[model samples]
Target chain A: MDAMVEQGPEGSFVLGKVDDLLNLARKNSLWYMLFGTACCAIELMQTGGPRSDADRFGMVFRATPRQSDTLILAGTITYKMASRIRLLYEQMAEPKYVIAMGSCANTGGLFQESYAVVNGGDLFLPVDVYIPGCPPRSESLIEGLMLIQQKIEKEPWLKKAWTNTKNPKDPQIEGLL
Target chain B: MTSEALIDYVKGLLGDKTKWADPEAGDNFLTVASEDWKNICQTLATDKKCSLTYLRNFTGTDYPEDDEIELTAHTFSYSEKHGLIIKTRISREAAVCDTLSKIWPAAIWYEREIFDLLGVSFNNHPDLRRILMPEDWVGHPLRKDYKQQETYRGIPTTRPA
Candidate 1:
């Protein structure tokens, strides 16, 4: 439990479990990789812009996958781009999250019948959240980010590693390998 | 000169090599034998009157019933402010045509696109590789009788239906 043991004019120190503190830090600063392939990218940019201001929640865009803790797929996934997506995902650090934004990334949407487009990102990626819209509004994208925050708060990162438990969302990874 | 005059000029230059198609509404085009395609395009590009210096568009169409594939090139001249459409039909069983990239460098990627989607081979093209599809992609997706593959590199190409 985290509690203030004493009060002072300068500041008060609080005691808490390392896991809670770590989760708190992680949930607040989710640096998402700047990756978008289609129209949903516009919405993503707007969400990061002043109007929606994703920065208010400590979410910011990172230029490289190596520095990002989250990936927001903001458009269609073509067969030619599938391997490239996998390569980027593999380059990210551990405890990474994936948000499949817009209808195209969710189920290939209107392009489901296309000869070259992949049906959905989940067919190859272990997506953590799905935002539904032809191109989801910025508000919904923020809500999706909050959902990821909630997920991060609940994860017992150290305990899971000690227990040797695997994430349930990794079946697609198994098939890919 | 207008497109009509340009077409007539091209007809005069290519003579026996060109077979003029009846102008449909405002669209005017001529069909040339596959063997004479390169020489005719050379003439149209170099000839003083028909200086077709710009290749506006290059594409192909499959005619399954006719057992042939038609390759179309739309050429325009900035100096003359005129354009003409030249087409050539090749046997479907062996869909090959001479590359016009030598005359119009813009035809390089256009030819690659046609080759990628329509399965038309451009003989002697500098770099005739798939431009839109992956290297290992099975069949031409735009062919009339093309069958979508079940999977591409282990990813399902079709959705659950």
Candidate 2:
């Protein structure tokens, strides 16, 4: 409730500032690592530029995966690059989110035929939200981000992510599925 | 030379070597023997009056039922102002075509797409690799006999209904 210093399950410092929780969510300003690997990457860029100005949604683009809060896997993920991407996902700090943004990142798009593509980013890492489009129009990405933020706000679980220790008893993971 | 005169001139050059694929109009379609595709492409590109400079597109269409693959090489000459669609076919069992990469650099991407989507082999394409699908993807998707796919790894895929 107060500024109590709590050591989270991951052994990281967590400030249990209940009152500041809402403010924290508002100010955290999600930083997205633009993983524009294909045509969809083009639309993702539009979201951040003058047109959609995803920046308006408090989503700033970052080049470094280590410094980002969100990973926008915006294009196709080939099998060759899958391992590197997984490593990048692991490098992000705790409480990180992933946004799978496009047909290729979601379902391999039209390239599902080739022997090279990994089909989708989901094959490598868990995705928090999916914004579907051949390349979802930039508007859709903004909408998807808003929906993710809204879900985060409504779920007390998101705020208590650190407090709720993952149960080892559950052998498998549960998800939006 | 306008599009009509250029096309008329090309008609004379091919004599009996070509077929009127779409004389019904709306779309122009001409069929060239698979063996002569290279010579025709080179002639179109360097012919004195027909200097077709633009390689509009090159693509393949698959027919699983017939076990054949058809390719289209759309070329146009700016000076002559003509657009010619030279098409040919190859059996699915032998999906290899002579590479036009040396003649038109842009053919490289199209040839790669054919290789990626249709699994067609361009005998001499410098980098004959999958440009569309993942480098390790198992099967060609556009083929009519495409297999049912599920998740790539543990992640469930959104299947096309």
Candidate 3:
């Protein structure tokens, strides 16, 4: 199958492993949910804007969680918002990813000692990539999206579906209703 | 108008109900008894001479050393362009104060926020509930001695050191 691309008539046909083809399609069009709870959300918007041009990497913002492939938690997660965040995560389709896109979302940032703020988004959601900044610059958020793209490229989607497997060390996030 | 004139105007209206007026400090607020708070606020808002019709800011502060919680209301008049600060102290154990929503409708949400953070209970705030914290939150977070609970609905509140 490796020689199929070279042997085929010019621009007529090509062949690749099913996993690679699927991953290729998945990595390019990562639809992130439009959710921002704090200051870092500004950077998230800037990343998607003209200068950072997140759309260039095939990343776009989805308004609802049901259609999103990525959840960028772009600010502080107070205890009150934690359950709502979990609900949003649960609503996202399977094979979804999370990018904790600021110091607050990463480790409660400045509000770490506050009575209301959750320590980090990882406490309630499985975070895929963490972008570190009080409010990370637009460039940093784009970098995080690129990291997610890289991560999607390596996932064996078909194999995992066939085995009915799950990610190892998935935290038990029960009773958050 | 100057703070002294404002204090004198309010004093002339409420008489002994105005417990003490401090015009020389940071806020220039008049401390009124909690029992007379509602009446005094009504007078301030309704009286043409001291028409403090707008509720500028309403907040509560917990003083652990004094064993009291002070509720302050900064009132302003759009037509007059003058403001007055009114304060009332409640025992921390009770933390109950009369609702000013009747005098100025804006006090409703402000009172709810104060209740949410400082544990102050407004006697007749129509819709009294938590405005900032979760409905099931354990304690008022703004209290000086507040201790955050370990977890909220199975989500840990603190990061591992």
lDDT of 3 by residue, A1-177 (tens): 132554545555666778788888899999999999999988888888889988988999999999999999999988778878888887787888899988899999898888888888888778999999989999898899899988888887887763214445654355666
Candidate with the greatest lDDT versus the true structure: 1
Candidate 1 lDDT over residue span B24-128, tens digit each: 586778899999999989988998887989999999999999999999999989999998889999998888899999999999999999999999999999999
**Candidate maximizing TM-score:** 3
- Which stretches in model 1 have alpha-carbon errors above 4 Å? A1-15, A162-177, B23-26
lDDT of 1 by residue, A8-81 (tens): 78887667677888899999999999999999999999999999999999999999999999999999989888
lDDT (C-alpha, whole model) for all candidates: 0.88, 0.75, 0.85
- Provide the fnat value for model 2, as a fraction from 0 to 1: 0.23
TM-score of each: 0.91, 0.69, 0.93
Query: Residue A34 of model 1: what lDDT?
Result: 93
**Regions more than 4 Å wrong, model 2:** A1-29, A35-59, A73-87, A99-124, A127-177, B158-161
DockQ of each: 0.52, 0.21, 0.70
How accurate locally is residue B106 in candidate 3, as Cα lDDT from 0 to 100?
98
lDDT of 2 by residue, A34-68 (tens): 67778888888888999788887788988888888
Clashing pairs in 3: none
Best by DockQ: 3
Question: lDDT by residue for model 3 over B1-161, one digit each (tens)?
Answer: 66678778777877777766544756666898888889888988999977888999999888999999998888998888889888899999988888988889999999999999999988878999999987878988899999888877777777877
TM-score of the candidate numbered 1? 0.91
